[model samples]
Target: MANVSRQPICTLEPKMQNTIVIGVIIRSQNSKIIELARDRFNAGTRAVWNFTLRDSFNDFINATVWGTVEYVNKLFTTFTIGSVVEVINAKVTERKINDPNEVYVPSVTSPFTLTLNQHSSLIQMHNSPNTARYLKFLNMPTKDPGGATNLNHILNNSETLKNEYVDVLVAVTFVSQTREIVTRMGEMTKIREFEVGDDTTDQTVSLTLWESEWIRLADKWEPKQTILFLADVQVVFNEKAKKSILTIVRKTIITENPMLKETEELRFQFQRKPDIRSTSLYAVPNPNSITKQMMIIEITSRLNNASVLPSNDRMQLLVVVRAMVDDMNLDCDDPTLISYRCAKCKRLVSDEKESCMNLECPFGSGIKSPINITSINVLVNLKDDTGYLVGCRLRDAAAEEAFSCSADIMRSEFKIVSSTYTT
Candidate 1:
């Protein structure tokens, strides 16, 4: 848990403020002294200063000053990169350098641009332990980052999209052919575009698979055909397209039909922890019985003791929800969230559309398997004595045991809201 602080989270905005701006100076550039005269009376040099400042929310803004010679130079000296400071009475102005048609968003998480007045005081607490106050807030467990994130979570979250690189699990919805395009330097290159989404989300993310090896993966991909592991992919929210965009780079790993059951289960556990108080909790296995028995634990957080965990094979963690994730998005109102997938193929199937997409599926396409055999993956959070992990997805036999009933009855009886924070 993070300590509470009354100090306001100061995000750089396009407005003048009389109060002080509190954040860390992430970057700084020295002001050049341009001399116009040799005489002592008015021979002083003019200086301009520019820098970036960030707050606890990871919001960043460019702060600059163009003023009388020594005034701007003084600010340049006081506010160095990585220095925490409180600037009293700052001015804000967007950089004219960026094109007006292009969005003003930073290529990174930064917010806007600002300028400090000559009279503004810079209170830099370099030696003090509170200097890195924002670091604590950043590390606070508001949410998990750095792991494979779903397209649904990315589309709904701006913070995750701001990440420089993210791993996403999505299925191919659309795929385009490789085409030649000239770069700004007039060099010819090949590129392809595709779309992908998951059951949790309605929107499809646009994927621009860049050449040279990535374009070859297109041959292996077909519409609604493959589950992909997109690693180290950069997400850019395209305003005009009204969807998140990503480009395949050399670092990106695009794996086809990867087995992600453990990954999916881990994510579900983290997202929504199982409720201990539910009447349906009868099926939950005894914590003591599973103590010596190991379940396959595939995912872990920093809080867990990795030394005891397995490296060669999957480890097991018998955990219950200490806290429940906000599941407003997956409540009774969204019937889709409570739906099911085929019994044999495990592909999603609707009452109206029961036929499986797989032609060679064991049950075969258009077989119309009964709805009772289908399944739905519910998201949850889980914790053991040592620590906790979020987004453990419970489904099938696991779901039945955790909920103390058939998957059908569990959906109708399971509570979306949780009251175990005190637990």
Candidate 2:
């Protein structure tokens, strides 16, 4: 076979300075590769290998060799677990941990092109009978006690699953909220909305369970029960709603399918432990200065009387009421307002109020009459640490100013929002 050079993949330099091509060969005696596996069989296996390299501030990284299957067999028969080998297309990654001393680690799973250009070596090593036997053992298929196989397999084999109408069956595994039954009708009673990627996606599609499905889920399902599968959903444009609405028709099945069944057996699979330390905090800055405004208020009461407000008004209100941002409404006819600073109030009453408390301010009041001003709402953008290339919110004037300035100037001028302390 003719040797074809793959497109060069770039990776961050170990010290987080520059991006080097994957196949770029560097000479470094200080760098060492360690095969940190439980057994010899585990060595060179697809797993995270932590190691340190010289000239790098962060010493730890996961080094994954892409062509390991062939390279492992042909390379020295018994190379030391921690031997120095010049990597071709290795990637650098930061180690996430509480310990400050931990170094940035590279992912062992990253694709890489080997430094050695010998294609014959790879083919010979990969074709070895021993390597074949090892792979056979590792990927051995397992059967359930009831003779049930993966439902995904059945779906994959069927043309219906591959149809454009059939978007991927996103197996949403989450902790059930209430006691509910898994009825034959495949309905969930009192079930909450099934969220994809935490209730929203850039793609705009959202999954919605019908009333009957919710009821069946709530009545028959138990809290912390995993393995609930929602399938056969349809995507609607819902242009008026401004978001894609995913509808699962009555024909949709809520089954203890193979994926869900496996998850059910593993009780803790649904639980997610978020990294609180690194998670970004939502904040609004005080207009007077660059300090972030803070408010801490407890819920006084909650109301659920649907008839109290007109259906049209209720629907309009619901559009703006986000679960995380909105306050609970009191039962009284004149509901007590949970106050937060309106941008206008915050700008005007710097001495009187630390943040906006006025409900009449144009920015605070939801009603728009004839103002040409753009709507004021918090906007989020993705970015990394070190302050360089931080995403900016279009509405944030301060962010716009910072973005226009040089990286060094921006870092010194704009204070990164931290949740530990608030103004």
Candidate 3:
């Protein structure tokens, strides 16, 4: 590749041919290959890779490559994130603000998008002393943190901000495993859910990564270690759960482990663990976030308050209760010991059904085989000198651990072992 004169991103114009631009790859999504129907009987496959490039001046633009699967895949794999690459002979096009697809593009200072064609555009690894200037863009946020919304404010006023977009600066608190599922369009995709929190509040909020690029990047993120500045993230409402959720739409731009002063402040806050009780059954890594011991009467009172209070208004807390099992079915062979629920809608479904039964669910209607998650839904009644807690459900890993049995255990042997313990 010739060291052609590099052009600044701010000066790029539509229809500009034989253009050379040099920048660092701040963000890049995994290349996607899809089958395209050209005619009634003919079909072909095409691959596209999308990434964001930022110049030393902090001016960034969205770039896309469209070509055969082999060409796009090679380009995507060859140029990893943070690589300073030089683009030659690429075409620049004016961005159509009114285009629906434009919403998916990252918000950049530039008003144009770069298009790299297989036959014309060439990408070469840039190696020069000037590369240091572009490296700083890797950790710089596109937006200022002064105007970003706090996680506390977003959660408190979620109803008012429904369907709106907001900027946030948060640190990763937890990362969940990725799950693969088929969408309503019959396309298979993967999603991973993770939780983040900021100094504004002790409450942590869960966010999901739908794109393969973000998902892959999140795999390396460490809990309480990685700080992020998210721009233009959509606030969506899940009616079934009766709460607001932050979703990573196409307009969302995530800056991982930003190097801003505000991010350092946030990191300092994480270094000093908060004094909060864990409200989860799973073991928390932090010893400071331990569960409190509560009497049965206190537990019942808290449950009553939670039942009447709005979901958004409810306070989160974790506690340990000391009580004797008043009622339980130790017979593991009982069919009621295990239950299935539609993963998408959280609705109960028969074990024999292949799809969710809730017609309103996206995976419900016309879905021949909806995805479902199995749970060990065993109900146990506990009693203490103060009061009795009835129908307390023990599910998932907790249930398996309590009974010393797993889902794969033989029914007869599980029943015999379960009978040994008197509840």
Candidate 4:
């Protein structure tokens, strides 16, 4: 009689352990599949196949098997592009596009597949003669038998269960409204939180920041810049919203800062563009007394004519110019050129001219005749940020004044600092 000793089953490494059971119905299977038959010289011919699983968030590897040629032929006779199947002994392999000899298998492999038989084997393997037996003894259906249904249940009841492992989130368009702060976690430790808006639902979410992330964030962030997190943060749903508006409770954590470098580079590039209009307007308030707020304008073109007026007059003169206007003054001390349509002839004219030059106009012959009239000159007296030119009429005089003033101011304010001495 031969004596036999019980042998220990080979356990998969933690990283390689296949938690997915065979015969499990995958809620979804997305993969690229290819099937080909091999012509073996001495050995029996075998079928070779490949598949790549794909979904919204991830793409994974899957293997296909029909067992033998007869089985494959019968199974794949009506196989379509999206036909689902269970897989077994599915190993992750890397096949070179250019060279077949370069094929290699990944260190890890998953035995789980959509095939029912494979899924059952997986569940049995995990439960039989293992610590997970308790889970099987509880009569809980094996993952292979009911994994998809269980997953769906978990997802549907995700709100009530408060599963911290998974979350869903949508981005807020108004980035300026979001706030950020740092909080202490333990002794000599801290974490960052990004507060985001959900005004439509009248709520907010916090994105937690881990260590090392703070350094990168601190390196380049401003008070009110619009940005997209690009799924780099997780969203924690708020139970309060669920009670009132059927919302989920969650918080955001900085998973990966893919946009940090791009954002910082973009900001620097924007700042380097030399805001000609705003720079010109910097002299408006007494340079000594001007606050940071007083010198900045929302529009980019306003800096074109900042220096034409004397310092005192510059402070008093408020010019709310439109983007379409241009300053044509020869001296640095004139206003900007405003353009308008002639009231009598409907001809395009500069604000400096009172009457339309069109000979076809019936009223062009009279001075102060509404047709022969001089350009209107309304004292602009404008406030730094309080005014906007929405529907106002323009005159030829205003155009000329704007041009002259802008030109003179630009010349005086933008004098190039000379670095060379004349010989």
List RMSD in Å for every model shown: 24.5, 23.4, 7.8, 26.6
Whole-model Cα lDDT of every candidate shown, in order: 0.51, 0.29, 0.76, 0.30
For model 2, the stretches where C-alpha displacement exceeds 4 angstroms are: 1-164, 167-192, 196-205, 219-225, 238-245, 257-269, 273-423
lDDT of 3 by residue, 1-423 (tens): 454556899888788766799999877877888789799874799899998889954599999998999999989988877889998878888888688887777788899989898887898898998889898887888877789998888877878999988999998776655665556775667776777889988787777778777777777776667899999898888765566768888778888888788887887788677433222222222222234588899978877778777765555444577899999865655767767667666567776356766787777854556777666777799999999999887876567777788754634455576576544
Name the runs in model 4 displaced over 4 angstroms.
1-161, 164-186, 198-200, 214-423
RMSD of 2: 23.4
Instruction: Identify the runs in model 3 with alpha carbons over 4 angstroms from their true place.
Output: 1-3, 34-43, 274-367, 370-423
lDDT, model 3, position 274: 43
Candidate ordering by lDDT (highest first)? 3, 1, 4, 2
- Each model's backbone clash number: 25, 29, 0, 57
For 150-187, candidate 4 gives per-residue lDDT tens digits of 22333345456453333222222111111222122212
Model 4 local distance difference test score: 0.30
15-118: candidate 1 lDDT, tens digit per residue: 54654656765445446566658676656666767554566654555556766877776666665544677655566555555556223222224444566655
Measured against the true structure, the TM-scores of the candidates, in listed sequence, are 0.28, 0.22, 0.67, 0.21
Q: Pick by lDDT: which candidate is best?
A: 3
> Over the full model, what C-alpha lDDT does candidate 2 score relative to the true structure?
0.29
Top model number, TM-score: 3
lDDT of 2 by residue, 11-97 (tens): 343333122221211111112244556775555533122221211211212232333444543343322222333333233444344
